[model samples]
Target: MIFSSLLFIFRFLPIALAIYYLAPAKLKNLALFLVSIFFYSWGEVRYFPIMLACIVGNYFIAIFLGKNQDKPTVRRWLLVLTLVFNLGMLFFFKYTDFFIININALFGTSIGLLRLTLPLGISFYTFQTMSYTLDVYRGEVEPERNIIDLGAYVVMFPQLIAGPIVLYKDVAAQLKVHKNRYTLSEIDAGIGLFVLGLAKKVLLANSIGALWDDIKVLGYANISTPLAWLGAIAFTLQIYFDFSGYSTMAIGLGKMLGFNFPLNFNLPYISRSITDFWRRWHMTLSGWFREYLYIPLGGNRRGMKRQVLNLFIVWCLTGFWHGANWNFLLWGFYYFVLLTVEKLWLHKPLAKGKIWPHIYALFFIVVGWAIFAVDTGMGDLAMFFSKLFIPQSGISAGYFVRNYGLSLLLGIVCSTPYPGRFYHKLCRQKKEVLRIAFLAVLLLVSIAYLVDSTYNPFIYFRF
Candidate 1:
């Protein structure tokens, strides 16, 4: 039930919104909770029990932590137990096969893969639940007594599948006051933003993604250096638009529902440094690690060496968090090296440079995406890198560029802040009619694209 699908857009959303709006103020949380469970169950009904267990388990665990705040030893043990429970579920479903394969390879044992179906949004909800428990233990937030409210927060369909990764504290107040938070202006803004995001996903990302898809089918060995680089750039754009589009849609939906989800992407492509890129890209995830993992591991407070170790741990886990692939590990290590170098030395020089820094950051970022995208194992990954770095002639990028040049241009331009700035300028000039017309056209065009195309894919759903 992707947001871009006609079924979801036309059926589920309208009906759900109608039900939600018609519900009494006191029953709003219950309405939201039930509707959200239905949404999750629509795609993965088999996993509803797992999600229910998580909601129930974490809710009680948090309550226990909140109650045992005065006892440090008991609270610490409960927090550890909570971590084990959340991480255990994630590990079993997401990484069990990876570990099995690795162990089989290392020990020459034919361990059959469990091949468990990962519950959708398990990664995201796990973090959200953990954050709630951790905050409760820290005395930062009172435990949510209302299980229905907590369940609604956990299974909120908008950001549930692939998130900006909303934390409990961020929406705790909004959940309480949702009755009063509804406004026509906010709904209008949400519609506009959702349409814009829909255009980005259906039009720009999917069209540009076709180029990379073609290159992949052509095989790494058959592609010219230019073609390889072009594919890398295309993938870079596709992933950004795909994930950012989903996040934008999720945020917009949050707005419509009277919740203010945090910003996820912030023109990350324009970042001149790896550090800057991380700050902009999947910002909530970065913040999650920074707050829960990095700071706890002493952060920069101890010394450079300790901080480096902390970063290594965070990046390794961050990489693994994306998937069980070795390429993801390399991708994380790749950024770890880049960020460590920048933190230790390159930051000053990057800031000092002008155009070259942007080029340098972009160059590495594109290469990093290649690593992230190629999951066919190390041989293909190495071959792809060879095609990218070593000049070889086979198929030129000319044909692909001719086919996708407009989409590429649009993607590049939209990746920056200029388009958003221009739109805002029009709004500031009181061009309400123009704004409304533009949004209407965008929505109609996006719906047309959705109706016509079968290539709609949400990249982050795998995570």
Candidate 2:
């Protein structure tokens, strides 16, 4: 279930946390593992077996890799086999339909679409499991000998559905020592963070998302250039807060459970360059590609030409990884081009500027969101871009600005680091009571919104 839902907030989380706290230290992992399975299966009971198989399959594969460290041939084959299994499951579940459609289009064949409902969190947990296998083979981490510990890591509900994509090595110690590390301070911090993230999702992202949805419900032809731009900008805010808000909740949940997941977002909207944006946005994914895909392909250590090619490959895969849509590919390639230009020429001059660099960065970022919003064909994309640039269209800018102006303003302001800085400054003044009250108010308001509304949807669930 989504973190924002009343069912999750009122019932599931409370019950789960109660059980977890009541369990003895030695049984905590078992409690978490069982609850996590319940969490995953709550929405899709049929996929429980699939998720369990992944945990069991990868655990044994990692064990084999760890055991055969001295046997290069065996280790290599095992690694390849494990990777194939992980990636094979991912592709079959996530991309089989896309492949069928593409083949039908190109070969003039009428292949039926599989239309399989993708197993939730398959993309994220598959990556997690694969990383474990790779780390074991490389001697970066000892294989997790206990299947329950491994299963808990893979299926932990906090970051399971959408993630910062926790790596095995990063959390191996935490898992081993998790039972011994419960602290009141950590739980307090987690409560504050969880409330703050809840407010971001319920108060900010969901409210702003309506503006985009309203415009979208009005077809592309019904929006003027300014309106189109405003809608695109609204979506940009919606996605940032939605994904980042969920990440915040995940990290907070990790804290509550005495584990630490890495931070996923870093105020990416404040970035002044595409290169800077990648470093800040969905940072774990970028780091994943850099470590597993980019660096292995020789990174920038190869000459500029090979580096460029490597980037292109990574971006294409990155886009394809997001979905089966062509627009996602375009979105990926769009960044590739921007990043390539930045590397080749733009970085120096952009770094030299102050205000203009931010303007430049935001201009491309807004346009990029427009590309991301459209999921269909290039023709619709062309039409949307035409309306965005041409002034020949529908609604007046005044109406949109009048209606959504405050939300837009709040979105712009909150996208920066100032709000967080202000909060920390308040905390340093020995304002513990004030901080507690603020979080309490935020939690109450968020709960009210959750009870009243059904529009809550975490955007990253599709991935």
Candidate 3:
């Protein structure tokens, strides 16, 4: 179940937390594993077994490889097999239907597609679990001996659903050595982070989500130039808040449990270049791709041309990883093209300017999300590109304000960390009046919105 859903927020989380704390320190891992299975089963009871099987399979594989690390051929083969099996499971479940449809379209065959159901966070957990096995085989981490600890590592409920893609090594120590009880300092930090994240989702992300949905629905049929640009910008903002909001909540939840999840976002929009953008946006995933895939395939350390090829492969896979859609490929390569241009031709002089760097980064990424969002065809993307430059109609500014002006403003504010930082600073003052007043207002508003919300799905759970 999605974290935003009533069942999860009210029922599952509360029960799970209660059980988790009641368990003995030695049995905490067992408690967590059981709760995680319950959490996964809450959505799709059938597929939760599959997830469990995969988890168990990987643990054994890693244990086998770790035991036989001295034999080079055996280690290599084991790692390869682990990755193949992991990705095979992910691909068959997540992309087989799309792949089958493509085969039929290409070869004029009428073979029926598998029509497989996508499991929540299949790609995410698969990658995370695979990382654990591969890293253990590589001697980056010792294979987890207790299957229960491994289970907790793979199925930690906070980052399990919508991830910052916590690496095995990053969270391994916590799994083995984590305390059962949280300190007062941990509790304070956790509460602050949780409240801030809740505000981001309930207040900011939802506002932008409505505007984004409205724009896409309208812009699909009658595409005006200005309106198309507005839609593109709206979507960019919507996805940023939606995905980042989930990550924030996950990180906050981790903190509450006395675990620290590394930051995922770092004001990516403020990046000066495409390379800088990758460094900031979804930092964990990029780091994973860099360490696991790119480096294995010969990173920039090898040579220039191979580096380019490596970059291309990563981007294409990154795109395909987003969905089975062609537009995502276009979205990925869109940045690759700009990155190439920046490196080859524009490196020396263009980046020297003040506004131009920010402008350059913003301009390219704005168009990039056009590919990411409008999934049907290139014509819509082209229309958006045209609208960004030329004004065909004045439908944008008026329509945006009329429909969701305040939300748009709130979204813009919440996408940045400024409001949260300011609030924290305000709360540190001696008088408890400000903190009291702020939470009271926030609680009333959040409750009001939650009561009215029908589109309360946490988007990243489907990742």
Candidate 4:
């Protein structure tokens, strides 16, 4: 269920919050767990058991690792078993089709594709649970004895679907926490954040998505140069607002329940370079790969060649993790090539830490999305790029400019953090009155958008 949905906004959340805060301190975890289970199960009842299995299995694996700290071999074995178990599920559910298609293409034989139903949030929840055992194996954190706490950690509804990818160690303290009371201030802040996120999704992301989806729907054959460019730019905004808006809503909900979830996105489009952009975009995932993957792979400690190889590996995984498509792999490698080149050469030269670098990075990323969004060939992406600069024969170059005037304006505005920042500054300038006015208008407008939207799903929920 989307956070913006009428049922979620008006019914589920309000009832959950009331039950959550009203429960006795000892029962708070149970309340959160039940609500979270219900929240996820509301959409995918079949996946609830899958989620439960993950939670239970990972907890035991972590506990085993914790108990066998002295035996590196035992700990390593436990980690590997759990890793395989988790990744095996993810592979079967998410990547099985992609693998099947590739094998069939290569050998001209149908390997009998497993048309399995992918559980919702399998990508996200699996990663979160895996991190738990991984951290325990790494000696970064001790295991939690309370299964309820661990369950809450895994199923925390806010960031559960797409995440800031909170580490167990980071939130272990909070899960172990209990509060006698939740204050009005906390509720107000949570409500405010949730509403703001709803606005970001409904008003901005959804609006941009309509235009971007239209361009992609046109495919390569019919699109004009300017239209392709507009489509590419529109997609960039769509992803950022969609992902960041969800993160904001999650964070806001966490606040209302007095849980301090980590922040995810940070004005990523404003970043000056590919490296800077990675640091800003989907920060939790970046941090996760860096800490869990890069660091373990010896990071920069092994020097340049290994660093480059490591970068390639991380990007490939990042891409593949997003989807089971070849485009995702290519898109990831594209960034790897760009990032490596930037680190080795461009960091000191053209587009170095300047506005041009941001433009350059965004240029690469948007084109990457062109590759990502289209379920076609590289030639198709190439055609779109060709059209982007050299106009097609029939359609005028101004097709995008003419057709999506308002959406274009909204895309440009929502692309950066400036709107949120400017609003904050304005609020600080006038404090109460302006803040209330802003909130009221945004709340009503977001509600209107939600009411009208048939396209309301938190994009990351299927992650």
Whole-model lDDT per candidate: 0.91, 0.89, 0.78, 0.82
Q: After superposition, how far is residue 168 of candidate 3 from its true place, in Å?
A: 1.3
* Candidate 3 Cα misplacement greater than 4 A, ranges: 178-181, 348-351, 377-397, 427-433
User: Model 1: which residue pairs collide?
Assistant: none
> Which whole-number lDDT from 0 to 100 does residue 414 have in model 4?
69
The regions of model 4 sitting more than 4 angstroms off are 180-182, 350-353, 376-379, 397-399, 426-430
**Candidate with best lDDT:** 1
lDDT of 4 by residue, 1-463 (tens): 8787888889998899889978999899899999999999987898788899999999888888888988989877897899899999899899988888988999998788887887888898898899888877877888878899899888988877788788888878777778643577777778788888888888888887888777666666787666777777887788778888899898888888877777788888777777878888888888888988988998988989999999999999998888877777888898899889988988876553556777787787777777777656767766876876686764543756666678768767767677778777865676867777888999998888778779677666655
lDDT string, candidate 3, 256-314, tens digits: 67688889998788778887888999888899899999999988888778888888899
> What TM-score against the true fold does each predicted structure earn?
0.99, 0.98, 0.94, 0.95
lDDT of 2 by residue, 277-334 (tens): 9999999999999998999899999899999999999999998899888999999999
How does candidate 2 score on lDDT?
Answer: 0.89
In candidate 4, list every pair of residues with a backbone clash: 225-387, 225-388
- Which structure is stronger by lDDT: 1 or 4? 1
Model 3 weakest 10-residue run by lDDT: 187-196
Off by over 4 Å in 1: none
Poorest stretch of ten by lDDT in candidate 4: 391-400
Q: What would the per-residue lDDT of candidate 1 be over residues 1-463, giving only the tens digit for each residue?
A: 8988998889999998898889999888888888888898987999999889899999999888877767989888898899999999999999999999999999999999998988888889999998998888888899999999999899998999999899999999989995676799888888878888888899899999999999989998999999999999999999999999999999999988889999999999999998999999999999999999999999999999999999999999999999989999999999999999999999889989999999999999998999999999999999999988888898989999899999999999999999999888777898999998888888898888888898576988888
